[model samples]
Target: MHDFDFVRPQTVSDAVRALATPDAQALSGGQTLLPAMKVRLAAPAVLVSLMHIPDMVFVRADGDVLRVGGATTHAQVAREAAGAYPALASLAARIGDPAVRSRGTIGGSLANNDPSACYPAGVLASNATIVTDRREIGADDFFQGMFTTALEEGEIVVEVRFPIPDAARYEKFIQPASRFPLTAAFVARHSGGARVAITGASESGVFRWHEAEVALTSDFAVQALDGLAVDADGMIADLHGSSAYRAHLAGVMTRRAVAAIV
Candidate 1:
């Protein structure tokens, strides 16, 4: 990483002001940022660390929302919400083992918006609210594309808010090397409906599967989605697997997630 001005602001307002410049970047868990920086892909002139902010590393239920702060690590999520949000907690626990989970934050995962990451699918399926310093975003609007999101420059994600669902489960096919999901599925069934979201398949990034959703929505049974096929047009091709293989895994994981939820 190149030499940069490091600002450890204690307040959200200060962090916002500090990141007002175009070259400034927010540093959360540094799980992705540090690696990207090492590869010389990220060379921010100023790095604003969100760790010092009070309440930015917490997880609790407020009103009807399960709030998880941006700086809150995956280990924290796994510990705090493990029983409450089983699927989300399971996903957090499976995030790069004990060491990475200890360092990787929920906010960091959301901020990086990696196409292959677990949280996006979990958030979307759980109908979570992505609360930023500026505003709140619906899960659908939060994720945009590969390494991209709805986050504006200088606008940082402060926390994530998820509504309690009736039941939820996550199933993933992880790549042996990086451990990122080759294809991951998050399924949540509430009084309203059942949502199914897939990660690590699409080129444009995380997306909800409407087909499997239809089956789960109609009948929450695993066998209900027997022949449902995931559309592969939007999926990405990679060395880990072909587009066809990933699309197949998307359906396989979708069924498995539905099974796990029930």
Candidate 2:
């Protein structure tokens, strides 16, 4: 790993200032960043730690939304959000192993925006808001592509606000080695409508399966998806599975998620 200056900031403003240093990068959990650094995939001049910022670590329900601080760990979400949003909690619980769960933060996950990561599906399906130090970005606009997001330099994610759905569930077909989803689906039904988000299968990144959403919105049942199918053209094809295979799993996982909620 390259030598880098490390700064632990106690406040969001301090962290932002620290990030202004040349080639500086924000550090939260260090689950993905650290690994990249070791392989020389990333070489930042400085590391601005957000873990020390108090306001970046919290979980609470504000009226209709479940507000989760950006620095809050996956384990924290698993424990704190279960009562208010069980589907989110369940997704958090299943991310990586206990060690990763304890260290990985929701903000880090979203900011990193790994195509196979679990949180994006939940955020997109729930139509959550990604609150940054500068402004609030809807999940639809936040994710750009694999390992990409709308976050700008020196910006920091403060928290995420998820609208509580009447019923929601996430289902994933895991790749045994990394525990990342090979194909995953998150289905959320609200008073307004039903939304379906799929991850792990798309080459472009996590995306909504609109046809299934429309079908399920009209009839909230697993059988409603019986005739529906996900197109293979946009799916990621690798050693674990072919594009068609992952596309099939997307439908299967979506069906399972709907079944769980129904």
Candidate 3:
């Protein structure tokens, strides 16, 4: 890793200020960033640590929303959020291994927006809100693409608000080595409608499976998806699997999620 100045800020405002410096990057759990730095894939001049900010590391229920701090660790969520959102808790429990779970933060996960990440599917399917230092962004508007987000420079994610769904489940075909999703699906049933989000398969990044959502919303059954087919043209194709195979897996996972929920 390259030499860098480190600043641990006590407040969100101070953290923002520290990150305003040139080549300064916000450090959450350092799960992804540290690995990248070691490989020389990333080299920042300054590392602004948010670990000291108390308010940015919590899990609470607010009316209909399950609010999770940006700096909240995956392990924290897995342990603390089960009553309010079991599906989310289950997803958090399955992320990477115990060490990665203890260190990886939701803010880092969403900010990094890894195409194969599990969080984006849950966030999108739940129609959560990404709260930042500057403003709140709807999940639909938050994720732009793989490794991209709507957050501007120096804007730090404070917390995320997820509307508690009536029923929800996330299913993933794990890429064994990395523990990342080979093809994952999160199905959520809300008062408004049913929402389905697929991750780790699309070339455009995590995306809503509209046809599955439409079918599941009406019937809420595994058999509801029998005829629905996922288009393979936009799926990610590589050594792991072909685009067609991933697309097939996307459909299968969606069925599994719906089955688990209903």
Candidate 4:
């Protein structure tokens, strides 16, 4: 890794202050950032670690929402959020192997906004609120596209508030080697309606399968999705899977998620 100064801040405000400096980047978990640094894909002059910030690591359940601090580790979410939000917890449990899970933070995941990452699907499906140091951004507005978000420079994700769904499930078709999804679906049924979010398949990044959501909202069952199809026009196509294959998987996974929840 290139030479850089590292600072661990004890509070969100402090971390924000540190990140305000030119060429300084916020560090959380280091799962994505450190690897990039080592490969010289990213080279920030200063690494401002958010892990030590007290307000950025915890899990709590409010009336109908599960609140997770940004710096909270996947393992922590897996254990702490199980009772309050089992489906989301399950998603966290399946993110990566033990080592990656232990180190990766939800904030980092969402901030990086990798198209294949799992949290975007869950957060979007749940219509969660992303609380940043600057303001609260709705999940719908938070994720702009692949590896992109609404966060401005130096803004820190303080917390994420996920509304506890009546029933929800995340189904992933893993690539096995990387453990990232070849295609995945997160289905959440609320009192008002249902939401279906697809990840790991779209070229534009994670997106809602609105047709499936409409059908599922009308009838929350596997049979509700009988004729629904995921369009392949904008799906990711590569060696692992074709756009058509991933599109097909998106439908299958969404059906599986509905089946589990129903």
Per-prediction TM-score to the true structure, in the order listed: 0.97, 0.99, 0.98, 0.99
Tens digits of per-residue lDDT for model 2, 128-234? 99999989999999989988899999889999999999999999899989999999999999898899999999998999999998988899999988889999998
Candidate 2: how many backbone clashes?
0
> What does candidate 3's lDDT look like per residue over 11-93, in tens digits?
99999999999999999999999999999999999999988899999999888899999999999999999999999999999
The residue pairs in collision within model 3 are: none
Displacement of residue 61 (Cα, Å) in model 1 is: 2.0
Of the candidates numbered 1 and 4, which has the greater lDDT value? 4
Candidate 3, after superposition: displacement of residue 116 in Å? 0.5
lDDT of each: 0.88, 0.95, 0.94, 0.94
Give the TM-score (vs. native) of candidate 4: 0.99
lDDT of 1 by residue, 67-186 (tens): 888889999899998767777888998887788888888888998889999999999998898999989999989898888989988888899999978888899898868888999998
Candidate 2: give the clashing pairs: none
In order, what is each prediction's RMSD in angstroms? 1.2, 0.7, 0.8, 0.6
> Which pairs clash in the backbone of model 4?
none
Off by over 4 Å in 3: none
